[model samples]
Target: MSSSSHLIIKNGTVITSSHQKKTDILIVDDKIAKIGNFTSDDDDAGIIDASGLLIFPGGVDAHTHMELPVMGIHSSDTFATGTKAALYGGTTTIIDFANQSRMESLNQTLDKWFLKAEGHVYTDYALHLSVTVVNHQTIAELEGIIKHRGVSSFKTFMAYKTMMITDDEIATLMRETSKYGGLVTVHAEDGELIESIIENNISQKNIAPQFHPINRPIVAESNAISRLVNISERENLPIYVVHLSSAEGLNCALNKSNAKIILETCPQYLLLDDSKYLHTDPLEVNKFVMSPPIRPLQNHQHLWKGIADGHIKVVATDHCPFTLEQKKLGLNDFTKVPNGIPGVEHRLEILFSEGYLKGQITLNQLVQVWSTNPARIFGLHPRKGDIVVGADADLVLFDPNIKHTISSKTHHMNVDYSAYEGLDVVGKCQGVMLRGKVAIDCDGVLKINEGYGHYIHRGACVV
Candidate 1:
């Protein structure tokens, strides 16, 4: 069969956000054409024997940063490497953040990022504008930015005074975006409080990464989230909270009266903890430094509970990578180190082995938070998330019994190390198909070419 011919996936337990059943899926050209009990007799068809495995629509990670320039250094992973990592791990679509610097134009920023990704991507990609200064002109660009540019979601940061928006800015941006069929995403954290706490800790001669989590406590996150929720509820606009870290933050989201609010947490928050910050060799702790730093172990139960009960709607990697050398920029000072980790490649395996295999979450819930809901929330649904007819043929054949250890040596992300190194995980993705073609084989190798990915023009957020 030709590489682009119709393919039949036989006898697989197809899983969706809320249902699962043994079935065969037929892929024609670039979309799923049918799903039923059918045997292919034509020689021009490619067949995938998916017995004893679960078939899930490839993950649509709505949150990721590729080749971002921050802290005087660029993220270690470029679009090529990052998307390749995502594909190997069963993620076929990623919605990355396009930064609008303080004095930069929204259109220019979008254009610049588009150039960077033009010929370097390997899987489908989209963008969400990161709004730094939300003034009248910035607000004025909403129609062109969302409707014309096809980027319907905007992200507002609350932890960097130079970049973070105020309550007024948040309110104004939220009001305007919602009015125009757009959604707002917030990096919730009280920058003033965190700055003061960090300053106080430094004054006490506490210069350790462990102090990183101490200064930015759970309340810092909860306070910001609660305030945003209050504003969203009052202004009648929906908000998405990114990288929710602690129990308090989860509660603030869960207790919200606004059903439109969506909470996104990362794999690091679910699998790791503050204990890594307390390592004896203080220099080693730089690897784990991230905003709203990993919370205490006690917070894990609450996060898992939230994930299972549907309070949290998505699980993304945040997928920002900085090499150890880049991290050492803050060796003399913890505050100087870059704050983010790499988890793009391990999201599926980690969630499947830890969350599902351990009984912390269900298989259907796994499909929901990791793929369907993310696609729905980010406007990539109906095409990227489900296995139904007419949807893009982005799919993964997962072997629930394949056991392995995660390590940087075998991973595709361009970063220097793996945050999940030495971790044992079951349930690996054995085969990945993209647009009617085999993209990744059972040997965990790429079968597609670089620049094979198409730029997706996503619609506005709907639920």
Candidate 2:
């Protein structure tokens, strides 16, 4: 077959969320031109021999906070560094939060995020408007963000009381989102419940980092999720639970009406446990300080079951980076430590090596949970997830035979330590192409020059 039309990925096994088939992919300009046995007729065509390899939809991480401003400090990685890290890991899209502060205007927050991300992303991305105050203007602005900006998801918190909307305010936000054909993404850990526990713990001289998980128990997350689910069911609005960590929390989500609630879990919940924080020096506790803090190991198995059963719709990095110097700010107290971990560059490789190759999930399931499902949920489905005709040729040629151990020294995120340091994975991104241009090649080339990544204006619901 003559391979001269544009770009041809020949003889690869293409895996979509719904189907697995062997085919050749052809690309014209930026979009996928064809997907089948094809022979093109353009002289400048580029050919990628993909025989004996697996080609799945590029991943869409629905939750990430690149260069996000928070808590008197900014996240460690800028948009350029963070998105570049994601591309190297096989993710082609992200949906970051446009967080509204209590004192800041909603428009200002959104505009700030836009400016920070402009000229710095290597992949397509979108935003979810986080409503901090539930006033008329805030509610009014929600429509503008959704209608004009194509942002169809809104986030409100049950936790972070000072930074979150009140229960009545949350209800108002939920109602507004439903009215405008948007989904509500909830961070469901009750602030009041957590506050009472923290006060008691501090009174008892139990102010160490080890006491954090004890203060924010499984019941805290479970009860909050139950309440959110009930509210969602009553409103008949679809709710997405972000960063779910507890088995009890998972049960709360699972027991809800299937059509009303969708759970999103992170790798930290699946891999880390509270045991990591049981240290007297307190510095050791910094590694385990993420929100909805890591739970028991048994919950890990439950999350795998949830992923396999389709109760969990997506897995995201929540990729918030903080360096050791910043983490040290909480040396004497765990409550002050920033809550996040950097994992964008490791999400795909770890899942492929641990979940799929280890027999925990099938190839089809991996494609869905990691790639296609997230795109559909976040309104970037066919364009960002599938390797089909009319889709962008944002592709990754992953080589599963290679083995490597992860460490901060080799990883891309701007952090001092890897949360997943020393973990071995069997696969790596052998090659990555952004719209038919080689962004990273097998010899560990990270070809990131400024202006290579264009800011993409996303669209509304396609799920």
Best TM-score among the predictions, by candidate number? 1
lDDT of 1 by residue, 345-459 (tens): 9899988999999999998999998899989888888998888899999999999998999999988899888999999999899999887778999787789999999899988
RMSD of each candidate relative to the true structure: 1.6, 2.1
Which residue pairs overlap in candidate 1's backbone? none
Clash totals for all candidate models: 0, 2
Error of 1 at 378 (Å): 1.0
What range of 10 consecutive residues in model 2 has the weakest lDDT sum? 454-463
Query: Once superposed on the true structure, which residue ranges of model 2 sit more than 4 Å away at CA?
Result: 1-5
Model 2, 1-463: lDDT tens digits are 4443477888888888878888998877677888888776665777889877788677788888887766688889888888888888988777888888888777888888889887778777788878788788887787777777778888888888667677677777777866666777888898899999998888888777778788888998989888877777777667788998888898887786543778898888878888887766676678768888888888888888888888887888888988888888777776778878889888888778888888777888888888888878877767787787888778888887889999999988888889888998898887777776667876768775755766445555543
